[model samples]
Target: MRGALNNLLHGVRLICAVIALLAFGMSVAAAQVRFDKQPLTIETGAGARHQLTVELAVDPQQREQGLMYRKQMPTDHGMLFDFDEARPVSMWMRNTLIPLDMLFLDDKGVVTHLHEGAVPLSEAIISSGGPVRYVLELNGGAIKTLGIKPGDRVVSRQIGSAG
Candidate 1:
């Protein structure tokens, strides 16, 4: 009986150790996600505009994992996707828990189109009707709240920096 109890205790300790290691690994990976702030300005035909701080998603891998699994984000925070070249771009929200508004931009940072209040975790393809090089994702309903329209523009120094 004593030997059996000792074995059980050892197994429990091993499980605990494994769980701790996995948790530590997750934290390490999350740490790699840098939220570098860049200004993204939006213009409305009503003679007004809004600015937001965005995190640049400049690489293929980062763009693939854009905002996935994140439970929440600040209202003023967003992600900017830099395609590095002019082309028609499509986006989906698979594995994303929060709704987002997607803005497609041309080479000059002019907003060419938008998808507002995109359903969370949806696999629907959101596309830029014309060739574009940048895409911006913000919280759902932000486009209406900020009065952002199709002709509105977005600006950031991170433009064309896909690294």
Candidate 2:
């Protein structure tokens, strides 16, 4: 009888462990935040238009994180890092996997500088010579393929409100 009771208790513990794991998995899945895809339009010289889907980072913390540790980013998807005040901006690709093209934008959303083909896992500082309030990161070759260049006017809607 004692041996039988011990076996039953062990089986109960195993069942509880499995249930806990399942609950944790569900919580993680629920916690993931998803944003609606939005079109970002940029007007090039000679009145040409280009569009891409971009994710917005409006807050300071989100802007700081800036897609760190992301293994893959889709061709049409990118992150737009925003700042409250325009200032000289710089970035690095530490722990990043995919190469990216960084579009540094002035307060009016005009692309002031383009840092194309940023290497992965590199700590080299990529900077916009002037103050910029926004930075958009897309696949490395996207800018060249779309004929994007400096002085292009870019537009994007922030995902969520400051509230």
Candidate 3:
């Protein structure tokens, strides 16, 4: 009887351990959030236009999980963050697996600041330089390759009147 009881207890412990591991795995998967995609265009000062499909990170939870653990992003695809109103914004590349170029835009959707070639997995703060209502993150070197610069306008329905 004693041996049977011990075996039963061991089996219960093993079941609990498996359950705990399953729960932890589920939570980790849930933490990787995905956002809705939208179409956006960048009209440069020199009469060049670039089109991209971007994921919208509009809420705090979506914004916080921006591009973390993403192994790759296509050149014509990116992420767009909307702050709801113009304010000073800052970002970092912690846990981000790929380099990016950040475009800071004001309320009018005009590019006000550009941070190009942000290092992957770095904790360095990338500031907007001034108050900005929106931020667009693209693959590294995209700014130069696309001829995007300050004064470029981002056109998207998500920006309301500025689109």
Candidate 4:
């Protein structure tokens, strides 16, 4: 009888451990951030327009988690970080799994600084040379392939422009 009780207790402990692990996994899934998608356009210097759909990272928590674990992003899809105001901003790719090209934009959505082909999983600091209100991150080499340059203007509803 004692042996049976011990076996039952062991089974109960195993069940509890499984439950705890499932709960932890659920919590982690719940904590993953979801972003709102928006339409954005980049008007190049020679009057060429490039359209893209981007996920907005507007809040502190969303910005903090900016594409850290994402393994892939679509060619025309990117993440746009709105800082709310123009200020010098810094970024890093500590846990990022894919290379990215970062475009720093001023208050008028004009690209001010560009950092292309940022190494994945790197902790090196990438900075906006000047104050910027937005940072648009795209797949590495997208800028050159799209012929996007520093003077290009980004138009989006969030940037006070018609999408």
On lDDT, the candidate that comes out on top is 3
TM-score of model 4 (CA atoms): 0.81
Candidate 2 lDDT trough over 10 residues, lowest sum: 27-36
TM-score of each candidate structure, all chains considered together:
0.77, 0.72, 0.81, 0.81
Each model's lDDT comes to 0.84, 0.79, 0.92, 0.91
> How would you encode candidate 2's per-residue C-alpha lDDT over 1-163 as one tens digit per residue?
9999999999999999999999787555534634345678878886888777887777665565667667788887888877866899889997577899998988778888999899999999998888988888998898888788888888766523211
Which lDDT tens digits does candidate 3 get at residues 20-82?
A: 999778558747676999899999999998999999999998898888878899989999999
For 1-163, candidate 4 gives per-residue lDDT tens digits of 9999999999999999999999788557646788999999999998999999999999998898888878899999999999988889999997788999999999889999999999999999999998999999999999999898999999998888412
The parts of candidate 4 lying over 4 Å away from their true place are: 1-31, 161-163
Q: Considering lDDT, where higher is better, how would the candidates rank from best to worst?
A: 3, 4, 1, 2
For candidate 4, what's the RMSD? Answer: 5.4
Error of 2 at 11 (Å): 32
- The whole-model C-alpha lDDT of candidate 1 against the native structure comes to 0.84
Per-residue alpha-carbon lDDT of model 1 for 57-85, expressed as tens digits? 87777787788778999998899988889
- In model 1, the runs with Cα more than 4 Å from the true position are 1-31, 160-163
Model 2 clashing residue pairs (backbone): none
Backbone clashes in model 2: 0
